[model samples]
Target: MLSRPSGGAVMKYGFPSLSNIRTRESYVSSYDPRTRTPAWVIERLGGDTLGGNADRKRCDFKEDDRSDACVRECAGVSVCVCVCARVRAACTQVSACVRPCSVHVFHRATNGDYRGSGLDRGHMAAAANHKWSQKAMDDTFYLTNVAPQNPHMNQNAWNNLEKLCRSLTKLYANVYVCTGPLYLPRQEADGKLYVHYQVLGTNHIAVPTHFFKVLVLERDGRQGGVELRSYVLPNEPVDEKIPLERFLVPIETIERASGLLFLPNIVRTSGGAVTAAANK
Candidate 1:
């Protein structure tokens, strides 16, 4: 039998950064307020967590309602109002109506930002991985868990990568997948490397230059061990015909590029035959 790890435990692994940590039903993530996207998201996938009566059609991409804008009123006077990026204009109107309107703003991307931005709201945590429960699937739709992605990339090659993660569940007893974005530097004409990317909407949601997925496959039964695989793809259209193995990269490469450490946690938690074909 598979030794079950907590579904979405905070202590399960070392996160890239400790800022703005949030846990959902199926995944644990760290939000980057500056970029308005998740720094990283980790989810556990097993046979039991694969299928259920969950309907994706019922789910919609939305702001993190758990921490939405709020206004505090004391003695029939509005004391403070914290507004989201999308409703800053409305907050201005409220401020005008109140004598001591103190407005503080929190940054979060909204659906309207992506409405005509020509970029898809790519999911850091794939929705299909949390089909075991509707709530789990719904959690994946939160805007905080998404980043700007090329439409073609999101629907084609990127989709294939997500499928590969699910397929691994059949081979291993469990699969722990960590997905996130990377801002790689490029050489400029002046012989210096620079990092640049587009920002969408009024919130200035950053579009990652590339994305990464690192998988930890747990071996089943008496012979307990784990295997590691990591892959990175650009945030643009890629030919679907290319084999995924071509995108396979060493775990350390992802660690350096995305500022995330995975091997240490794997060694600490699963003390056994840990091997990685990707590094070979």
Candidate 2:
């Protein structure tokens, strides 16, 4: 049932900026050596996907592979072609279809962004858990362009929520989140040094589900502030919920211990800063 709008093709999923947003034109347009670094959330790490200087790794499977997973009618007959789960092969579920993905297949996109090694199949507007909006057909939701984010958060926490939040979308459609000593492109050249996590797990998922989102402001050596702005969907956006320690505490604690809170959602107040930019 899910098909592209303009051309009536299968749809794709998306990822982040600073690790956040730009547009598809500026996104997939040819790559210039000057801007070898990716613009999307995956640029931080996953940037080295196919064209980057670094070697490819795991966690990418969920985003990179399974392009032809939709109904591909060939030879005058409608046929269902399920997408393969990984680059290698293992488990698969029709629900986990990649949409606003963060990597690329072809070496170059029509946008002119020369498909380079650092490129990723990014999704401008996430393809997963897309019931919230209907812009999938627009280039805004295209998988060729998106932002940079932690691979773990993109696939596991964020991705998990996409499926889990399906039924509960009625009660609390979206969740705003702010997790770390956030960092972004203007802030760092190579992108964040630490990995990001969506403030998920046990307690954080217990919110009443309204118009709530987490804001990640970076707090450097001198308590600077948060930076990134991202959101997560809960398994069940129960109308009756609270800030249970299950989700809140660990987030704060992780940041205090971390020295530099470049990777937002992962750190909390109790967590230490991994960077000594201020203390020194």
Candidate 3:
């Protein structure tokens, strides 16, 4: 059972569970808005790591605080990662408009960034996952959390994957998710695939060729072990009819491509027992 800090009530299966260790990354921001130096970063709040701690640090959102969700803004890349816990009871349908984060100028994205680009304002941290509160839901509308994604892929395959994440709340005590962009390699006429991607606007906002989602699920009971799932999807239009199972990939694959680690402590606790399902 997972216990809520606010209510102090034990729930059989909770939406956001505690993590054994912090999962935020430390990097150098090359942008000029804030001090361009090395710093620790946390994208949003409401995940397994709620408050600021020694290991996990939070970013300053300057003026665009929504008071509902947390944000980790990468001014250098002009993209932000959003984190939140999905509670079925607090989930509400709310219509919100997309806007810019008024914080450190280049730290976030803007509407003009995607103006003529043949791409959708892809969300790194999905909006629907935060249906628990209208403010949390609206917090997702910030341009900083979006990337230039192929319209078809964003609306179809990616949407299905988000739905699957939400469904896991019913089976696990807590579900912690980390979503981000990937600039991967692609094959050309010569058959040699090269790593390359595009950027948009004056800020040079990166348009990832692929996106990744890493999910950590804690079982409902004391003996329930941790499970890790990772996926990488192309930024192109995918056939909606394709089964989502086709995208299941090994966590190592993501770690290798993104240069980030997920659930490092839990991975050691399970003795590396978390195996990737064979992509069928």
Number of the top candidate by lDDT?
1
What lDDT tens digits, residue by residue, belong to model 1 across residues 23-101?
Answer: 6677777777788888888888887678777799999998864222233332344321222223433454442212111
In model 3, which range of ten residues has the least summed lDDT? Answer: 21-30
List the candidates' TM-scores in order.
0.80, 0.25, 0.61
In order, what is each prediction's RMSD in angstroms?
9.4, 19.6, 12.5
Clashing pairs in 1: none
Backbone clashes (count) for model 2: 99
lDDT value for model 3 = 0.51
Candidate 3 C-alpha lDDT tens digits along 1-280? 2212221111211212231111112100111122111111112223332322222112222223333333333222322111222332243542222213223454445576667988887666565554444444444444545567898999999999987877777777666566767677879999998988777766566777788776766665664566777778998888878787778787778767766655534523332226322111
What TM-score does model 1 achieve against the real structure?
0.80
Which runs in model 3 stand beyond 4 Å of their true positions? Answer: 1-103, 189-193, 268-280
Query: In model 3, what is the error at residue 138, expressed in angstroms?
Result: 1.8
Model 1 stretches astray by more than 4 angstroms: 1-11, 66-105, 268-280
